[model samples]
Target: MTDYGNIDVEQFFTGDPIEDWLDLKRREDISTGTVDSLVQKLQTNSDGTAFQQFLSNRDVGVLDATVMDLYDYRDFIREVNSKREMKNKLSEVSTFYNDMRRLKQTDSNPAAFVLSRTDTRVKLPNREYHTVEAMGDFLAFIPHPQMQTMCLCYLKYGLRRGAVVNIDLCCVNIDDPRYRPILMNAISNFIGRYAAVRIPYIFTETSAQMMWLMVRNVATETSATTMSYFRSTTR
Candidate 1:
């Protein structure tokens, strides 16, 4: 039996290089999700014929396929796919050849030699920003104090919704005397443990006070059992 790292090539090489490579991947304990994705990519093509069928039609096994064969396949991929998709398809092909080389099934990776003419870097669309007046009007329409505070936090800190939601009460320190009673109540009921050192918070003094006031009102009004500063009453 041919020893290729941990895999026994003699037992697994069943004439189909793609099937052998996939089986090797499974033997290596690759994640099921990852293996399933690879299988889907190999079997599905826009033109009804899969990559293995394309190789078979060219009268070449994967291990014996030439660089020119890969270039032709790349062209086929480009015909119906986006530049990004073509890049991904070629990358998967290259990965398969790389594994073949590792298993000593092939001496060279022909897919690695294939090159593309298209610029594959996907450009993100430009985002439009609201004017100051527009932002004020939008904030004015949000009726809940908690939601209004959350929106203000987004505008002031440029924080994502998830980040705002995950902000624990212990993360902020509001020293305003007017809000001290509410802050004390929150601290007493706060279930989350404080870190050894103060966590670096992004909120300014005014914004922190606003958030505390909103939290205080929310805690008093709602039956939310969650200890998170941003309490949701809905199940």
Candidate 2:
């Protein structure tokens, strides 16, 4: 956060704190997809977003909001939505407050304190793992060669769909006696420094052959053509 003593309240305050904070987000270099999603959430939700509804109900300025106000919003989300949904809503509100605090718009972050109170454990559904026989069936089911190769990458290396599409041909060196055949380069954790994330392709010869064939095809394909096909097919 910026120096508390240096923060000029008169300069920062614009009579409407929520409008000013939202305008800050608009001018920020945040992802367009993220902004769109946040906007859609506020627009689509009948009760409005956690903070939006809170401000509407209380008719209080953003700077004047208290920790109790945040708890009230959290309770409101829990009543109308699942715990997981409440968690997400709280996170968004916390992020907004933290951003404002960092910019010297506010001294305290009420949502940050409320986050601990709203934490809940969400249960996940059981998943079935694919056996060798099941794998063969899955491979056979996918008729498209490139798509099958992509699936093989997922099955053998546990590569995410996004990572599979972004795998660079230059990083794949089959001749190198490395444990992993393919490397997902410069995968940023966002929380830490960038690092290379390797996905092992140490499966059967059939899978390796399919992967190598796809690699060869990718190597020969033009960038524009590959991107066009990737965009069209993925969508």
Candidate 3:
């Protein structure tokens, strides 16, 4: 027999198992927002029976619920809930069963069996793509040099916002007269250290020059050895 020494098994097995699971989640330091969402998804009765009451009516405890019972519940919710809401409900119940299994309270997770099909019910819309001319017009109107350089990087490299923000000065090699003034000033302190680094040029010469010009105009002090390529001047 498994030894559940000092474990309060009664907390999970007696009264409402859903409430017990939520209480345990609170003790585990789950964020209040997450716990409130779980409560809304699992216990709210705006449309029909609460999940706990539904299980109770069927004479099925959380540990004893079969995959078929969960499927029946899915059908019940489908009548009133949108496809996305139905999917979220199933996902939260699956998480509840998973936690019960971890505590050795049940041998099977019935909710897990049905979660795989939840995505097939919801159809996602196709993404729209912008034409090059449209993107160019948009870039032309962005008043700031920094914003223009960021848009150029996105256009050329398909870089995400975080990826663009995380770019370091040492990553690119710029060789343009427009950039020389700012580049000389920005890297004056790190000349010897980065001289032989030989990092390849990721940005086009024009974009690199624009980025350097933005950096020179915004930064009051250029003494740092290394810094992010794009940063807020207000800081």
Tell me the TM-score of each prediction against the true structure: 0.21, 0.19, 0.20
How many steric clashes between backbone atoms does each model show? 0, 0, 0
The lowest-lDDT stretch of 10 consecutive residues in candidate 3 is 217-226
Indicate whether candidate 1 or candidate 3 has the larger TM-score. 1
Arrange candidates by lDDT, descending. 3, 1, 2
Mark the 10 consecutive residues where model 2 has the least summed lDDT: 183-192
lDDT of 3 by residue, 194-228 (tens): 44565322334443444443343233123122343
> Residue 137 of model 2: what lDDT?
59
Question: How high is the CA lDDT of each candidate model?
Answer: 0.55, 0.54, 0.55
lDDT of 1 at 122: 44
Candidate 2 Cα lDDT to native: 0.54
Candidate 3: residue 208 lDDT (0-100): 42
Model with the higher TM-score, candidate 2 or 3:
3
Q: lDDT, candidate 3, residue 156?
A: 52
